[model samples]
Target: MNEQDDDRDGGCGAGCGCGTPGREQFVSISRPSDAPSTAGAGATDRHTIEQAVIPAGTFVMGDSSGDRNAGDGEVPLHEVTLGSFSIDATSVTNDDFARFVDATGYATEAETFGFSAVFHLALAAPEEDILGQPPGTPWWFGVKGADWRHPGGRNSSLAGLGDHPVVHVSWNDVQAYCDWAGRRLPTEAEWEYAARGGLDQKKYPWGDEEPDAGGTWRANIWQGGFPGTNTLEDGYLTTAPVRTFEPNGYGLWQPIGNVWEWCADWFDPNYYRASPAANPTGPIRGGSRILRGGSYLCHISYCNRYRNSARSQNTPDSSMGNAGFRTVSR
Candidate 1:
């Protein structure tokens, strides 16, 4: 199917052709033990993956009249039907990822490349120099020793950040984790539906009102100028605990902020036009995969796509400071 066809239903489409460069090639990453027995632990224990029961039903998928800045790709609100399934209630955290890495010895894209791009604002020094930087988005710098474990590179550790959503993961890394855990990434439709928490066409997981409701914060997004200034008004200078913010109606945490979660579908800007209205899996074949949920770096000035309906794309091998994932099962 064409990109326009997939875009019609909130699945990744136009820019995700299968032949595109950097699409991930799946590799086996060994699974760790089941879920942690205790709640609110300093580190996430490997608990059995919890499945969210998304009852078979329909919900409005996009924006048409509201959100003036909503991209053309997210146009023409449509209906989508999904089957019942369970999803992880929280985004994968650093501890959860650490176990996976320890078990498989599987090197991540960032680990293989010896560095990953981190947002300037997330770095201690914005002007720090690094070699072989890629073009575009001057705010992105390649930091050596940066990975899921050391988010900002050397001297960084997940010690206190165990409960926080893991970052610096690529689509390939997410897939490896999913395969090992006997789970799969949610389809784009499934992700958007769960993110909405049963609300229809709301700008965010919570609702249309901006989180700064009368000067109160709702989610963990960038508060001030992006790539430069950060007011840290959200009580977080970086990633917050996965459960730091209030959960959506579906009891899902960090669905709108903290970090972007990778989804199964390949990304194509124009996939929704002719996309199937029921349980769309995205185009059958494509390159870049879809990532949902805005990251802590999200700001209205640059990338405010933290809403349930918001979407973004990434090369399968591209990992960054604000990218990670969750999983689902049938």
Candidate 2:
């Protein structure tokens, strides 16, 4: 409980809840179509509401694999039984979010705050030109005009990236989107259950297999280096289109490597010890909400938490270039 206070609530875009105001003005924006109709041409087509049913079963949770690198939060591998529930097979895409934004004229927390965190590489501007950087990670720059539409900054666009997961979305933004869609964020247990994809106690979405096996690149992750340069050996400098890789046993796409998805629970490092045997919903209150799976930025040298048991935390309103969410239904 003495860890760095997680940003569970009471803030704006991606920080300790301090930023710009005047969100009511967003109502002036008119609704638009579902992302220009060409978001995913010749790409995998799936219903926006399509979901896979995760059957009721008991599965081992956390790091039982003896990975010395695993964090303390992943320890004491326990068992959890969850009832039948359904979840979106993929992270919410730009097109999906576009419909929500158009319908409600909802300005994301980032837009309301007038800025959001962008991967430092995204700026490509002279160091002096960048406005500022977060205290913890300088790699995360606070770039002006960065939101869901312009993920990089003022100049970027979601043109061909419509099929990609919508980033620069705060936890609050995802909650509103889920409510409008008549869906809910998955609990940490449910998320890990679905993420395991019927495979019990395995690292990554597919058994213990390495991401790049047989010279076939798997998930989209930093290839060459972290914070400085990326060789893009995995065919992406940042996010790749949803369904870019094969699905897991439960027909889930990119379960391990993609934008970190928000979970419906307050994060506690010690929660697993007392987690329910039937269905655990995490702590009643905490500093931060839970984030699962790794992102395009995850690498072995830094954050390698792309496994079924790996977990991370962030403030409820925190939005990042590598953060996104999915939804579930009872």
Candidate 3:
């Protein structure tokens, strides 16, 4: 799509308020590219796909209990039915992302913008300077030079993080990669179904219990304070390897924590109330896309969207330090 068409359709475009001033205007999008495949002859061997078979059935969607503080969007938990489909067993890893980048030279929104919004604990600043940083729960700061390759910014590298879930990717970027791979982003129904791993109406992929099952770590999540103090009891302060945690019954790992995966649905909180009982696809159009799973940055003090029924939204063109995606094929 051309720049004008992209902006109109909310596809990938340059002026999405994501790029820095005076930087190159190249749009980091995941649209279909004519560029040759970068999946070298060896690339095929490096990647593996785990399938999650969702049976055709119906289940309740959204929070059964209401969040008094929640907006009107996520209301009236309703029923949704979905046909059988398969989903990736895990979030897309750095290695998988590297293949897409190699083939298309596809820069992520963060790469093109020259930085990304990173949690404060991930930043290096003097005690005094920390107080002067931009305010957002005192944890999120717009750090320049942060991307998938250099997650923590210029001084950081992905040398030891090749197995970690790829970050700094926008929904549009993930969609583009899926298209190139002859796959597609999973609809919200499909994602929730896969996330549940065949379970019905449970708070998490594993169950209602928190990841700290009897004082044992079940997934990678923020241990201490929301953005500042992370004890790292989970053995990670940031993103962990994609398969670092145990898989659910359907063999899906990190569906509740580690990183948020983009869904194909346009987010409308109350849409679930009026949604079809079978194969709901969300609203026809909206300002943002739906994101599933919570990231390591999630905390109960603030954003508790890590639950399987919990949902979040973001602009399709927006990229963040903890955003990535996986794919599903028919």
List the candidates' TM-scores in order.
0.82, 0.83, 0.81
C-alpha lDDT values of all predictions: 0.68, 0.72, 0.67
How would you encode candidate 1's per-residue C-alpha lDDT over 107-200 as one tens digit per residue? 7767776667666555532344343333435556567667888787765777788888888888877777776666778998999899888888
User: Taking the tens digit of each residue's C-alpha lDDT, what string does model 3 give over 8-101?
Assistant: 1211111111111111222233433443333322323334667667678777666543321254244455677788777888888888889878
lDDT of 2 at 151: 86
Task: Write candidate 2's Cα lDDT for 48-86 as tens digits.
Answer: 657888899999887655542323366567788999998
On TM-score, the stronger of 1 and 2 is 2
Error of 1 at 315 (Å): 0.6
- Model 3 TM-score, all chains together: 0.81
Candidate 3 at 262: error in angstroms? 0.7
- Candidate that beats the other on lDDT, 2 or 3, i.e. the better one: 2
- Predicted model with the maximum TM-score: 2
